[model samples]
Target: MQAVYSLPTDVSLASHGLGGFDELPSVDVIVPSFNEDPRTLSECLASIAGQEYGGRLQVYLVDDGSENREALRLVHEAFARDPRFNILLLPQNVGKRKAQIAAIRRSAGDMVLNVDSDTILASDVIRKLVPKMQDAAVGAAMGQLTARNRNDSWLTRLIDMEYWLACNEERAAQARFGAVMCCCGPCVMYRR
Candidate 1:
């Protein structure tokens, strides 16, 4: 529960952030989904497509043998026109990790971001996150997350707070020592 304030990270924050990174690395976002709601999946993909990063970006949506055939077909057709979004269909029900690994093998991005299929990214998520990876010492970086359905109930609100504290406190404190222990599945960026 305690967030350390004394430890200073090796890197200092830069203004505009565009100048912080020596080079804008190509990013590959891998979204792994099973039988996720069709609407939610669309939203997630849309958010990634809307990112403001001024670098090459690719999205690989791995369908881990979803049972809803019609929904999958609709999503495939929906994003068919965009060259950035590639839908990878699996023959059978492989696990989420396997699905992600499969996409990683086929990608040629300088940085890899793992985003959950149900998570909607902020517009500037990729633009802001990639700078942190400029530090050679950094292993991975995780962004702050709050449940989109946080206002539904008290429990949801509590879960949202947990997400905040985990990122702002625990993860932030750990970053000072270059030992942050999260590449949280919801949103994380690391050099490939």
Candidate 2:
């Protein structure tokens, strides 16, 4: 899979006085979505596109046969316009786990970042997690998840609280275990 932005032109991405080059780990972010709300998806993508890391990053949009053509169009359109983005549309609705595996197969990076379609990443998310992959046994590194739409409704607020509490407890356990069975569906990063 080739990025729309290739060589030379892309290579000239140097900042005037950025003190030359520093080694940075590459990352691929895989996001699975099925007919997600457009506004939410936009926010999610925007957050990723806004990451502050200087590493080579790629985004995989695994389309699990979204029923809404318009929503799918928006995602594909973004992919078409952005070299860092890739769109993999499944012919039929497959499970989320399957979609993730497919994205992994297609990813071309030193590490992987798995996120929910409706979730957004913090600007420093990648910079914070990618460095941890340098440790040989560190298979994965997860980041904090803060709800972005908790005020949308009472139900959303409740879910936000539950998610927050669950994440808090899980993070503490993760610190002890140094491993997580399944990283949080949103805001988690992994090494290849």
Candidate 3:
């Protein structure tokens, strides 16, 4: 993926307390949705709203032409109270990649967090991920992901195991070489 802006390499972690999170930069979260289940989307939004990051943060929810009116209404109602939440409703159905690109173009943050509509993040996710971007050479950082419905079925449990292996083992090996090939789409942070 291409980065939209240059990252600073001179940031120091010593001044700020633990992880230098007090120096967190502005962040914009881009969420792309196309016919997503309303309940799942609500949970995802709630998770984002509950983030404890002290830095400036905004959410851009892109609706890629969802046919379900109820889903659209749910999104509007759930996020209506927050001024930081912005909704972009495309006139026609667009693919996820295109939707994300559109949001990225409009984003005004120092870093962008691209999250899937179905994923729910931990409250400190951004706090943990932002520190990785302090290294100018690192263009992106990704968070660990497990099936949100892992207990719903045996298949989901198997998928959760796969996710663990991918995030813990494979990605860890790649990080040692500074050559991670793919960032998990469920939750990822990028410089600009």
User: How many clashing residue pairs appear in each of the predictions shown?
Assistant: 0, 0, 0
**Least lDDT summed over 10 consecutive residues: which range in candidate 2?**
1-10
- Give the alpha carbon lDDT tens digit for every residue of 76-134 in model 1: 77876699988899988789999999999989998999988888887778877776777
lDDT of prediction 2: 0.71
Off by over 4 Å in 1: 1-22
lDDT against the true structure, per candidate, is 0.78, 0.71, 0.78
90-162, model 3: which lDDT tens digit per residue? Answer: 9888899999998998889988999888888877787777877877788888887777666777877787877
Q: Name the runs in model 2 displaced over 4 angstroms.
A: 1-22, 152-154, 177-179
The residue-level lDDT of candidate 1 at 102 comes to 90
User: Candidate 1, which ten residues in sequence have the lowest lDDT sum?
Assistant: 1-10
Per-residue lDDT tens digits of candidate 2, residues 1-192?
A: 000100011112233222132467678999888877777777778788888879898999888888885656865797558888888889888989899999999988988988888776667677767655556777776666555566777876776776666567866686688665665667677777
Candidate whose TM-score is highest = 1
What's the C-alpha lDDT at position 117 in model 3? 88
User: How high is the lDDT of residue 21 in model 3?
Assistant: 39
